[model samples]
Target: MPAPNAAAVPVTADHGSATWRLIKAESKLCLRDKVAPLWGVGFPLIVLIILGAIPTLREPVEGGGGLTYFDFYVPVLILFNLAILATAALPITLAGYRESGVLRRLRTTPIGPARVLTAQLVASFAIALVAMILFLAVAGLGFGVDLPRNPFGFAVAWLLAAAALLSIGLLITALAPGRGPASAIGTVLFFPLMFFAGLWVPIPQMPPVLQTISYYTPLGAGMRAFQDAYQGNFPSILPLVILTAYAAGCSLIAVRWFRWE
Candidate 1:
């Protein structure tokens, strides 16, 4: 009888290692893409400058108990930047990769599709984290924004927001048919969702009907949670609950509907 073919045995460990290697490669490609860094970091900083320049936002509070508008707005700005970057970049890049057969080509390798997707998510989160830190630094040093009283609370809020937005982005990537359609849908979704986020206008100033509507939107709830952190107030637990539910629901939907092609 022929000698047992030891080499023929499937090496699951090798597959796991190869999957991670492919993930790293995909992350590098994403980082090298010029637009990702710009939108992720540049546009948000511009908004920070505009917020700092406003005379009303710069004025110090009389009672000294509350932060100025600039201080109030900085955390919201950071959250907004994270949401926009993750949602916009993930869908577009994933769709483009799928359309171009980059994801498909990986099927022939030891790397699995899920690993590739996870890599992209991780890469985006890493970039967003860096952008957020830089934004805080600039807001504090350049614009005189105050640090949050409860740093742990602030960190928790940021992580929750990232989880919620990243889930939505993944859902878009999995469900949207093609690059063009994904881009079109993302474009339509981003601005309207962001407007309710209180980035462009304060939520209190919005009409009663709109206020009620905004309460249900992810961006709005996220902004409220973030605002509470900035002002050193306790965040509403309800919004965090809502965010967790949304993330769970979106992730489930994405997994069920994801298309490799």
Candidate 2:
């Protein structure tokens, strides 16, 4: 039998163009999904309102001056919303693309498979940024939450948190090849992370053991870092450091195990 012809393999020199095309396509598709945008953005805002309405939340802090519970919880709420969207939506989108042969089909085209992944990342990040802006707007305008005193610190914290969450999402997509299972895994992670991270209840109110564990969880650390930024507190090096480490570890696992087909 004759050996297979290597010349039949597809290759393209204009990979950058292909990547841009994929990014645009992904953006359009994501925007057209009414339910996703509602769930990703609206649900979080609703949670913020409900949490902010709690009587204890509205009462002044005992010794931390007169900051309202709404003011104090706003940062945690924003980060929690962003984390949930990243964890839940990203994995499902990726796994669905893979399961539906979107990635496999792209391999036969001039576009590289990596472009599809990049497009998905860019689209997801865009949605995340919008959610962050909406959260900030609502808090600042509607609830009298002040802007971050250190804008630079706030930006750094946000970027690091996004990176950490994105890495975890990618890791989930790599490990769970099917869309249903990927969503299930994300659901398993979503609530606990949010609750322990102080999205539902104040960390100080939790039991000592739970508080200790929460401090070490990625979502908790991210929320703490965000809270520090919003309150104009000096950036806490530990949470950012832990987030960086988690991002690195998750990225490594994702890259090693990811499959296109």
Candidate 3:
């Protein structure tokens, strides 16, 4: 009988080609996915264009160190893009693959569940990065919005936030029973998280109590980090710590509970 895990590629072999191919395939699948492409990439760019067209949004945010309302929202939308990819698109697709036995079947091939998971993560990260660049491009060229002043700090914050969000995605996939539940759970998370990310009201405009609460939410901390980067400073330690904690805690739990079949 074939070993169930015959597909688990081991070290000491040049597995780079296989890994690269898997990533390419997964990235193609992500691009072909209607829901993720629509909401994750297209939605954010469209909203950015609309916001840029609004003259009122060009006004400077009070106490934002000369950042326009449009500028503030650029990072919010970036966070939103990541949220959709992580919470909605990723969990749902993986759960569906699980439900349909795709992950289980892969164990019999040259590629295994672990590699597939890595490919999915790479695809999602690539998509998120592309969407972010698109957002910045449209904002900069079409609307004259400046890039983040602290580019290194901005990159750091973005990486941490992505790790935190994607780890949560894996946790959702590990915990949910099937695709439907995963989608439902993701939907339930999407709105409230976006709320804390300042999707509507500016964080500063929020009531003091809510502002205090916001900093504790995932996107809230991420938005704070992005804002600090935009203002030419490293993100505060609190938000970075919060993001790292989430990434570590959730990833450990997800790995503990994740199943192949």
Candidate 4:
């Protein structure tokens, strides 16, 4: 027989291959769920197209400091896409997996529970990122909204915000006992986050009190950081700190409370 260490190498390689297969399978599942992509990608693009059709929205506005209303909404739509993925789609799928015994069944395999969870998360994250890129392309080519000027800064801020939002998604899954509850809670949280992020109202135009309050919300702070990067400025330290805290804190809570069943 070959040496034990040599035998172990095949096992490790096999495990890695298994993980990739799992990620691909999860990705396929996401794709099959047409509604998820509809809300996560299509809806935002449609809204942007509709908004772009308005002549006034394309022109510079006093409230927007010479940037058109369309310019301000581009980042908001990107964030909105991310939010829908993290809050609505991710939690529901994970919770469904848990409820249907898929996760529990994986416990008996070489892959292990954590690796399976990681695969699912990675798949979902990839989908969200793809949706964001599509949004950027459409915004740039169709609407003439400038891409984020500071690409590196914008990327960092986006990754941090995605982590924070995804952590919140996991936390929601951990607490919700079933798919219905998970979706319900995610939907409830989604609207408020959108409002504070200035989905319906521009952050600059919000009352001073609401603006101050929005600064503390994850999407709110994230929108500010994203907007700043859109205009070629480094994001403020406070919003970065808030994003970090939400990511770290919510991840800890999720891990601590997650149920395999």
Cα lDDT tens digits, model 1, 1-261, are 655997687787855676566667767887788556778778888888887988998887666466676776776688778777756778888888789887678667765545666777777787788888888889888987777776777788777778788778888888776788777777788887787887677788799988888877777778878777766777789778877887788877776777778
Candidate 2 has a TM-score of: 0.85
Worst 10 residues of 3 by lDDT: 9-18
Pick by lDDT: which candidate is best? 3
TM-scores, all models, native as reference: 0.88, 0.85, 0.87, 0.89
Stretches off by above 4 angstroms in model 2 are 1-16, 52-56, 109-114
Task: Give lDDT: candidate 4, residue 11.
Answer: 50
Which pairs of residues collide in model 3? none
Best by TM-score: 4
Model 1 residue runs over 4 Å out of place are: 1-3, 10-19, 54-56, 60-66, 107-113
lDDT value for candidate 3? Answer: 0.86
Compared to the true structure, candidate 1 yields what TM-score? 0.88
**Between which residue pairs do clashes occur in model 2?**
none
Provide the clashing-pair count of each candidate structure: 0, 0, 0, 0
Model-by-model lDDT, in order?
0.77, 0.78, 0.86, 0.83
Local lDDT at 160 for model 2: 80
User: Over the stretch 61-128, how does candidate 3's per-residue lDDT look in tens digits?
Assistant: 78877878888888999999999998998898788878888777876787654566677778888888
